[model samples]
Target: MKEVVFQASLDGNCLFLNPAWETITGYSVAESQGRQLLDFVREDDRPCIQTYLEQVKTGKQSSDHPVIRLSHKMGSFRFVEIFVWQTLNKHQQVNGLSGTLIDITDRRQAEAALRESEERFRQIADNMEEMFWIRDLRERKFLYINSAYEAFSGLSPQPLFSDENAFLDFVFEPDRDTVLRVFQEVEQSLSYQFRARHRDGSWRWLRVRAFSIQEGGSPSRRIGISADITSILEREQILEVSLKKEQELNALKSQFIATASHEFKTPLTAISSSVELVRYYLNREPQTPFTAVLTKHLNAISDRTTGLDELIMDTLTLSKLDEGKIQVCFQEVDLVALVEQVIVANFTNREDSRQVAVSVLGDPVWVTIDVKLMSHVLTNLLSNAFKFSSTNPGLVIEFSEHAVRLVVTDQGIGIPEKDRAYLFGKFFRASNVHQIKGTGLGLAICKEYVELMQGYLGVDSTEGIGTMFTITFEK
Candidate 1:
């Protein structure tokens, strides 16, 4: 913002210095008036400044000056950018030089600091073993990715970024659906393990995470990382087979799960898509018996398909947790909004949206949890509340400075006394609720999940009154 105006003779002697020059260079107009312009310039820069003035003086250049540093009255040099042009007499001959020197010391220093900071970060990112990336979710393109990506994948990012789906082409076909599914669930940050094609003609396991980035309270982009987890997956594969020939049997169980999940997901995704199409067409048709019937069936298909997708994911999560293969990513999350979302998803099929009442008793709750896993835990509890309750279900969230507590209460047949002791055992179901269909893995998975998040789960119930599941975690 500083500008010092000056007029100089053909030989570069200062003939005039404006008042602004005194404030910038710490030299009064009287002291600067009769001095040579090059006398105040740094010795190293005087030549370039002189050369620029001479060029303009001979009409070889029009309106330009070389940037130079001037010695200040305080015995320091201040960087300034000069813009000079030759003044012309009425006869069109060069008369003198007129110019302005704008101080840019602070701006130059800032630019240098930024370059150093970027280099520091670049060094760290380049040497990382894991592949890190940031994507502009709005544009569906990568903003940045590290060198490790090309080193591991043996593929440059140029083409992959050019075509949005080009990266997916390298994913194993069976794992593609799950990968695409995760990207579409864009409301929250999530992570999962999947297999992808590697450069050495082998399949490698990758643990990838995606987080929705928000600006102004809305999603603006995504940031994610992918790490090679083949060794971990190999261990899981070995552990799944008989101990005698464990390593050799690596392919058996992993393939079983992958194949089973792929089969389950593929058909469900197709069914849901088809149902949506049918629903869209039916909406345009007049209200008739056949149309009503078709619409109802389509709706049923959509709901059932979604339930199946959840079931597949939950089962896989339980497997990972039991095998000690699950990786937790803890980050700050809005516990209240997460709980509210779970409730909304569960009650989507209900006649009244208020079937499950959620009461947040305290201030906005923020906690550190693996959002993907925590969401699964909350969804299980909330879904159970709605499924078992004959009347309206009640959810209470109590958050304090020291801790957070959530209580999900249902008004249906409670856990029998005998079953209460083994309620969390895998496949253990209460005898009274045998008619209700369930995997019996819900409570067991939830218990492991809550504990994994460094929290505790408890239950209170009477025979026919209800069951209230309580969760507690230190803030």
Candidate 2:
């Protein structure tokens, strides 16, 4: 019913028209009956219709099918396909034409819309900076590649359509095998970061990501984008070189510190010995005022020389630790005995030794620890406790089946809460302890030693109240 059936004389006069003619062109069947069929055709297309009809009338073509624009009653044209054949009389001679006119306006408009959409897509793809491509994986052919590919690869995109592996030929030799493997094994998605030779004879870094597109019952396609990452990689290389240079400078600075400390230690030792000799001789006749003054200055010099010597020793020890020259030798030692020995060795002769108390709580704790490192840790902690607190400094040893803990407590000016996080950092001294004499390296060295023995050294402190330092080791 959508098509109109009609008969017209061979001279092009309309003899009969169907009711569907009104539906197709907004013209009544009676009004269109007597008019020529050319009256309903667009003026520009009438010549084409005339030529086709002439050919059919002269027997040059048996039947004619021509798509032409027909004028509608509303001042617009509609596309229609005409299928006409000659009608024969009883004498077997052509007399009239019979045809069906089907409205094809919708199909024509759809085709036009498709062309416009394809144009828009092409424009967008061609303008991108990154290379975009589409390949029919099933057909082993490249379907689409943007102009950026030609710009980046310095080659025509034509050969790629026929030879899918042409780009692989330009891939840097070191990365070619990896790229090939990735392509062969790819399933849903793939990503590759590699270097490839560019048009300028330079290797360029590219980061490519590809995804498989499989539509219902259609051949699979691969759509991917490749971006130039050469600039980013260059920046990273520069940063790596800068970092290496900085590390080398730090190594040189450490060497200088080690050398200087060793050179100063010998003179400091001699100064301390000379001061002791002067003091020993002056003590025989030291009742006079001048001799008393001389003794006081000598004692001051001796004390300073001893402090200098201690500083040099601490510096040398830290340097060795930094260079990884100190090796830990672990031996099973009694915790209680070790604590007592460190206390007697470091604090027994001092006046504050009386304030130090030792307690063994559970059992005789034994731990595998480096003897020298453990001794050093115990000495530092106990010395700090006695120096900071006015009352008793408690050293408690607790033991269990799986763990051993040595807790050192002091009721002194505790570290500030804000400074506790950085307490163990090299040369980091709490603000509250600025007036106290310390080299600030003792805790840092202690922590390193404790960790080398596979133990943990932790601290808890409250400003103006107390501090507790704990060293824990697993059996």
Candidate 3:
């Protein structure tokens, strides 16, 4: 037996102690022979042991009492349940006591640890943010849910167990069919995400995941967790709507700019031809009154009109680029000659133009490129140089059968460091260039044009010093 049985004489001296006692106390029969029973008890428990012995001897109690701690040879206490009866002599007078002692130390400690573990589990489950549940899959019933279910559903868990299918009523009707379909399948795992109708007439999005517990390959139970995701869903919906509206607005803006630019180009052409004709007449009569004044005013008109015309054309180019409407037809052309013509026309049109020093590395270098787009790229780069540079700027054209580079460098006020990253973005202007008369679309259009020919456009600049624009086309 696991019980430690022992007997003591009326004087409280040990008369017999069993093998289990030796095993428990680490004291053999020879060592415990002459010792009193109280000798093995701890000092603090000695009084209790003495009192219990007195009660048993006087017949005040028997068979059961509160546990007492006894000392083991290892110096640790062992709790034991002791039952004692009065031993009788042949004359029916009380002699010594015979008792049964059961060591309950392991049992007590195990009970304490179990209580602590259960409390910890309860605390975690009760305070959990996510809903934890266990359900009988075949019976279609919820067997367990934590306290969190009350806060989520605004109902106590007890009523949920009173009737099965209570969870179905919380699910929105539109989502019920899908939920039913998912649960109907005998799968090992199931997950559901949908809106569930809340108690207050509002809908809450819930994400539920479960794994089926099976017996003999048949569905038996399910363990599931659910979390509320309403706030996340609402935020995503708002962002989607905002993105759709922004895209629509950008499309309308592009169409408007394209139409307006197309309308402006016709009048701009007429004004340029009329200005040329007036200049032709004035030049023939060089001795005419206020001849210089007439020339200056006419030139001012021409410059302003040309600036307006360029802005409109830049806007139109940006619109077409946005719509991917630019056609790139590759044809062989003398790119060196084409660049020279662009520079000459730009300089000839300006009354007070900066001198552009040109260097050609090869004679009549032929390349395959889109003629119109390349013309725009050269014009934009040279115009930017002429407008910003204070002295002679250099334009170098280097070409070969496999590669071509057109580099334009100027001693102009360079782009600010902060603006360099956004320089090619549409309608983005440098912080320092606010006073310059520009629509901020020139570099953007130039970049798109170069990219259309499968070429690269890059800029090197230091603030307040100088800037260089490089366009390279490679086969």
Q: How badly does each model clash, as a count of residue pairs?
A: 0, 0, 0
Model 1 scores what on Cα lDDT?
A: 0.82
lDDT tens digits by residue: candidate 3, 1-475 = 5587888998888888888888777788789976898888778878877888889899997555757777878888888877877799999998998887788999999999999998998798889998888878777777889987778887767866867556777888999889878756667887889777766779899998889888887889887788998998889999999989977987998978877877887888898999999999999995666988899999998988988987887777777787788889999988878877887777665566556788887655678889888888888788788778777778898876777899999898989998899999988988988878788898998898898888999999998888999999885
> Higher lDDT: candidate 1 or 3?
3
Worst 10 residues of 1 by lDDT: 246-255
Model 1 clash pairs?
Answer: none
Better of 2 and 3 by lDDT: 2
- Tell me the spans in candidate 3 whose CA falls farther than 4 Å from its real position: 1-121, 128-130, 136-143, 173-177, 184-189, 193-197, 201-205, 211-221, 228-244, 273-306, 313-428, 442-475
Candidate 2 — which residues are off by over 4 angstroms?
A: 1-162, 169-193, 197-203, 206-236, 363-365
Q: Model 3, residue 76: what's the lDDT?
A: 82
TM-score of 1: 0.49
Give the candidates in order of lDDT, highest first: 2, 3, 1
Quantify all predictions' global Cα lDDT against the true fold. 0.82, 0.87, 0.83
- How does residue 401 of candidate 3 score in lDDT? 74
With candidate 1 superimposed using the best TM-score fit, by how many Å does residue 448's alpha carbon deviate from the native?
Answer: 22
